[model samples]
Target: MAEKLTDSEGREDLVYIKTEDGSYRGWRVDLLIDNLSSKMEEKILLCSSCKGMLRDACFYEGDLKCGVCIPEGVAWQPVKMNREIVSDKMISCPVKKRGCEWSDTVSTVMHHLEKCEFFPVLCPLGCVCLDGERKGKVMKLERKLIPKHQRDSCPLRELVCEFCMNTVKGCEMNPHLEICEHFPLLCPNRCVIEGEEGTRQVKRRDVSVHLANECPLQKVECPYWIYGCREEMERKEMNLHEREFLHIHHRLSITDMKQKQIQMSKDNKLLEEKLDTATERIVLVEKNFESKSRELLTFKQNQIETSKQTIDKLEIATKKIAFLQNENESKIKELSKVKHMEDKLDTANIKIENLEKQISKKDSELKSIIEVLYSHISLATGQLEWKIKGVKQKIENKESSYGDPFYVGLYKCQGNIEWNYDNTGKVVVAICIVKGAYDDKLHWPIIYKYTFILLCHINSYYNYEITKQVTKEDLEKYPNSLKRPTEMRNDGLGTRSLISNTEILEAKYCKEDSITLLIKIELLPAL
Candidate 1:
C-alpha cells in the first residue's frame, strides 16, 4: 500500500494505486497522499505492478518498496505517508575551512576537538607566547632571577675589614675608632729631641716627666757638649761654666739596686714559712716508721711460736711410729708359721681326694657283678640293702676327708697374729732404691710382685680362691704402676696418714746415697 499528501502550500501531489494482489497498476483514488512537498529522493515508494526502483514516485501502497518493481494485476489500496526531516548539518566536518574534507555527525565532531593540531599551546611559566623565540628568552630570564634573589635574601653573608685585621661592617666603623688601641696621637709636650723631634709620644703617663731631664739632645754649657768631656750623658744641660762632668746612668743604676733589695726581703719571709712546714712533715714520717717496725717484730714472734708447736707434734708422732715398728716385727714371725701350715694342709687334701676316687671305682665294679648274678633271684630287695650300706659308708668317708682340722686350728690362731709385719713399707722403698740405682730398670715387675703378694695373703687369710691370673702383658700395659708405691706414700704423708698400712704398702720410696734412713718417696707415676 502507499500514501501521499500535500503541504499547506499545495505543491504537486501524486498517489499511485496498489491492488490487493500487492501490485501497482496506475494512479488511483484509493491511494492516500502524504507530504506532497517532500523531495522524491528523500521519500521511497514501491511500484504496485513491477516492484522496481521508482523516480518521481510518491506513496503507492502501504509497503515501502519502489513503484516500478511491483507487478500488475494486484488488488490496490492506499495508506497515509509518514515523513521524517534529515538535516544537512549532521554530515559535515567542523574543520572543513582548513581543507579537511572529512564529515561526521554532531557527536563525532565534539570528540575530534580534544586532539586537534589547531588547538593552542601555552608556555609553562604562564606566558601566552607559543612562539619558540620568545619562550627561550623567558626561560633564561627566570634562571637569572633565582640566584640573585637567593643571595640578596640569605642572612649569613661574610663581611671583613681591609685594615688592622679586625672585622667591622659598613655600619660599625665609627664606634671602633674612639677606643682603637693602634690609633696614633700627637705628643702633649713641646720639648724637642734630636732624632724624635715631631713624634715622641710618651708610652707611660708616669714616666713622661723623666724624658725632659734625660733628653740626649739637650745642650751642655761646658766642654762636655762641645770638646768631648767623656761622660755618658742623659740629663737636662744647665748653663754652668765648669770643667767637671758626671755620668747620668750611674745615678739610675743605684736607684734600681735599692728597689731590688726591697723585693728580696719580702721573698725571704715566704721561704722561712715553707721550711717550717717541711720539717713538720719529716717528723710525722719518722713516727710512722717506728710504729710499723714494732708491729713487724710482734708478727715475727708469733710465727716462731707456731713453728715450735708444729715441731713438738712431729716429734711425738715419730716416737709413736717407733713403737708400732717394734710391734710389727713380732707379728712377722707368726706369719711365717701360718704360711708353713697352709702348705701342709694343701698336700693332705690332694691325697685324700685321690683315695675317695679309688673307693668309688671299686664300689661300682662290685654292684655290676651282683646285678649279673641275680637275674632269676628276687634280688631287688638285697640289691637295695647293699646299695644303702654303700651309700652310708661313702657319706662317712666324704665327711672324714672334707673335715679341715688344720684350717680350724689356723683360724683359732688367726686373731693372735692379726698384725702381721707387712714389710711392704720397707719393700717398696727398697725396690725404688734399686730402680734409682739402675736408672734404666722398668720397675713394673717389682710393683706386680708386691700386688701379687698382697692379693695372695688376703686370699689365704680369708680362705678365698683367686680365679683370675695377673699376666705380664697386663703389667706392661700399665707400666706407671712401677712408681705408684712411692707416689702413694708421699700422698699419705701429706694427708697425715703416714702410719696407715695400706698407704705404706702403696708408696714408692728410694734411699739417698747409701743412707737407708733418709727415704725419698715419689708422688707421681713414672712415664
Candidate 2:
C-alpha cells in the first residue's frame, strides 16, 4: 500500500516500503501521504463517464469523480471531504522501531517526527575532514549518540591539553602536546631533588631554573675559593671537603686575618700621625688659655667681694625658707592624717556595701525558703502517715527518737517516740510544732483541730485514735501552747502515756517490730 502511493508528480519513489529483509527505502509514510493530498484535487479527480483524469471537477461523487468529463462542466469543485478523510487516518511514526512510540493522524504525524529525539540525526559537531581521501565529508551520527561521539570521538571536538590547559581540536591534541613548553620531562642529570613538603611532583620548568642556579648536585667552587682554596666539587660535597681539609682552611683564614691586621696597622699609623698633628694644635690652644686664665683670676678676685654680699642676703633668705619648710612639714603631716581618715572612711563604706550585699543575699535565700514552705503547705491536704520501724528494739534499748520534720498546713512538725521522758518510765508519742517560714503570717494561738490514729496490724477495729479540738476558751487557757512558735519549737502536745513499754511490745499495736501512726490536721479560717 505504501509503494502504491505517489507524490504530485506521480512518482512512487516518495513512499518508503518496509521489506521482509527489515530494510526501509525512500520517503516516510506521512511525507508521501501529505504530498499526494496537495495534488489530489487536480491529479486524482477522474471523469465518471470517460474514466480519465479530470482537470476540472464541477460535480462530485464522493469527491472521487468529476462532471468535467461530461460536456457542460467548465469549472472545478474540490474533493474536500476526501482530503479530510485521508488526512484524519491515524498512522504510526516511521521511526517507531527506534523507540519512538508516537502515533497520530497523518496530518500531524510528520510534524511529530520532526522534533522526535529518537529519530536519527546527523552529528551536531558537523565534523568535516580537512585532509586525506575523506576530505570535505561531514560525519553523521544518531541524535542519541551525537553527544557521546562529539565529547569523546569527534576529531573536530575542542579538548583541553592536560599539560598547558590550552584548548585545541581533538585530532590536533597529540601534536599540541609534542610542542607544549609546559610539558614535563625528566632531568638530564637525573639528580634526586627533594620535592615540596607533601607532593613528590615538581614543575619541570621550575626544576630547570633550580638546576642552573641552586641545585646541590651541580658543580660549584668552594666558598673559600677566594681565600686560596681552589677546590671544585658538587655543592653538597663542598661542605665535606671543607671539613676534611679544616687545617688548610684554618691556615688560609689565618693568612687572610693577618693581611687584615696589616691593613689595620697601616690605618693606625695614619691615625697616630693625625693625632700628633692634633696634639701640636692643642699646645698652642693651651698657651692661649693660660693667658686667658690669668685675666679670669683677676676677674674672680673682684667677683669674690660681690659674692660675699650676695651670700649674706642668701643666708637671710635661707633662714626664711627653713622656717617655711618647718611650717609646711606640719601642714603636710596634717594632710597625711586627713588622707588616712579618708582612706578609713572609704574602707568603712566598702564594708557597709559588702554588708548590704550579704544582707540582700540572705533575704533572697529566706524568700526562696518561704516560697518552698508555702507551696508545700498549700499542697499538704493536711494528712500524714508516720511509720516507726524497730519499735520493739527501741523499747528494749530505752532509746529516745524523733522523726524527720514535715509540713502540716503552715506548721513544721515532727512525731517523736520517746522511751522515757522526765523519768515518766512510759513510751510517749507526741506531735511538736517547730518554728516555720510561714510563722509570722499564720494566726497566733492555733485554732485548727488535729486527729491521730495508731494503726493496729492485727485488727483494724483495734486501732486507737485521739481527736484534739482547740476551742476559744481552750485557746485562752493555753495561750503559749497554742501560739505560733517563737523559738525552735513549742513543747510537744500529744499524750505522754500513749503505750506502756510492756504493752507496746504486744502484737495488737506492733507488727514486725514496727508501728504506724496516721495524723490529720484540719485548717480553720483566720479570725
Candidate 3:
C-alpha cells in the first residue's frame, strides 16, 4: 500500500486514524492524538471476523464494519479494540498554538498539559461572567491559575456575606448586601440613649433587642399610662413594674373618668336651671307688657271724646309702653346669656363623648393585657404545655427536599421542618416567629428571645436535645416590631439536624415507624 502524505489544509492540529482495508487517515485535535499505538495497533482495534485493524473504505463493509474482518464476503457488526493501546510515541503539546515550545511523547504530553501555566482549560467554576453573552456566567482559564481564578476572581464563586448570614455569588455580593435588610447596621436609636445612661453603638439587627430589653435607660410608658396613669420606667422593668401597678392604674383611670362625667353632668344641670329661670322671667315680663298695652288701648278709646284728656292719656301710655319694653329687653338679655351657657354645654357634651370612647378603648386593651399576663404567668411557671406533635408525618413527604421548608403552627414560635436539605437524609427543624395578636402580652419582635429545644424523647429527661438560640437578626427579618404583627417571616431560623438517619431509625428516637419530637421555646430572661 502507498503512504498518504501531509494534510490538505496544512493545519498542525491533527491526529492519525486507521481506516478500513488498511489505510491511514487524518483527524482533528478534539480527541487524544495517541488513541492508537504502533507497537500493538491490534490491541487498540481488532476485527470481529479476522481480528485485524480497520483499513481502507474502498473494500468497505456496511457501517463501520471492516471489509477485511470477513476476508471476502460481508461483515455483520463493527469491532472494538481488544484492549487499550498505551501510547509512548513522542508528540508536541496540544497548546502549541499558545506559544508553548516544549515537546514530549504522547503519554507524557498530558502531564505537561496538566502542569503548563499557559495551557487553557474551562474555568474551574465555569463562570461565563462578563458583558454580552457572558454576564456573570462561566468561562475558561489556565490550568495552573485555577486557584486564583476560582477564588474571589470567579464571578460564580460562593461568597459568605459579611453583613448578613446569606451566601451569594461573588459578583452579586455587593449589590445583594446593599439591599439585604438583615445586614448588620449601627443602631439609629443610639443617639436617643446617648449621654442619658447605658448608651452605646449597637448592630442594627440587635437594635430591637437593645431598645426593647437591654438598655436600662430606654424609657417606656406604662400600658395604662395613656389612661391617666403617669408611671414611667425602663423597658426591662416594664412588664414586672406594670404588673404590680396595673390595678392601681385601672382604678385611677376609672375614678378620674367617672369624676369628669359627674362634674359635666352637674354643670349641665346647673346651666339648665339658670336657663329655665331666665326663660320664665322673660315670659312673665312679656305678659305684663301685653296687659299694659291692652290698658293703653282701652284708655285711648275712652279719651277719644276730649282732645286734652286724649293727649294726657296718650303721653302716659307711651311712657308706660317704653318702660315695659325696657323690662322685656333686660329679660331678653338674660335669656341670651343662658343661651351662651347652653352652647358651652354642647361643647362639653362632645368632649364627654370623646372621653367615653377613649375609656372604652382603654378598657378593651386592659382586658386583653390581663388575659395575656395570666397566660404569660402560666407559661413562666411551667404550667402551660408548649410542645409540637405530628412531626414524623410532616417530614415524611419525600417531596420536601432541600431549600423548601414546611411550617406548623397558627401563631408565634411556629415549627418549621425541612427534610434532607443537605442530601444527607437528615431533617432540619426551625422555629419561626410570626406576628401574633397578643400585643399587650408580649414585647415587639419578642424582646424575650427564645432558646429552642428539640427532643427525640427517648424516655423522659434523658432524651437528646438539639438547642439553638433565636437571634435578633432572625427576628428583625420578619419582625412585627411596631406591636402586634399580622404576618410571619418568610424564612424560618434553624439548623440541619445534628441527629442523623441512624439516630432517627433507632427505637430510642423513633416509635411505630414514626417519631415524636418534643419542642419548647423558653424565653431568655432580660439581661
Lowest-sum lDDT 10-residue window in model 3: 401-410
Q: How do these models rank on lDDT, best leading?
A: 2, 3, 1
Using lDDT, give the best candidate's number: 2
**Backbone clashes in each candidate structure, one number apiece?**
42, 2, 18
Q: Which sections of candidate 2 miss by over 4 Å?
A: 1-106, 110-141, 150-185, 193-201, 204-216, 243-248, 267-527
* Candidate 1 vs 2: which has more TM-score: 2
Per-residue lDDT, model 3, residue 237, is 81
What TM-scores do the predictions have?
0.16, 0.29, 0.27
Give lDDT tens digits, candidate 1, residues 330-406: 99999999999999999999999999999899977866654453333211110000001122233223321111111
**In what order do the candidates fall by TM-score, top score first?**
2, 3, 1
Scanning candidate 2 in windows of ten residues, the lowest lDDT window is: 1-10
> On TM-score, who's better, 1 or 3?
3
lDDT of 2 by residue, 348-459 (tens): 9999999999999999898788777665564343667888898767776778677778777776777666785566668776666788867865556665667778888888
Best by TM-score: 2
**Candidate 3 runs further than 4 Å off:** 1-90, 97-99, 106-115, 132-137, 162-172, 175-182, 189-201, 207-527
TM-score of 2: 0.29
The residue-level lDDT of candidate 2 at 229 comes to: 91
Residue 481 in candidate 3 has what lDDT? 37
Clashing residue pairs in candidate 2 are 57-76, 57-77
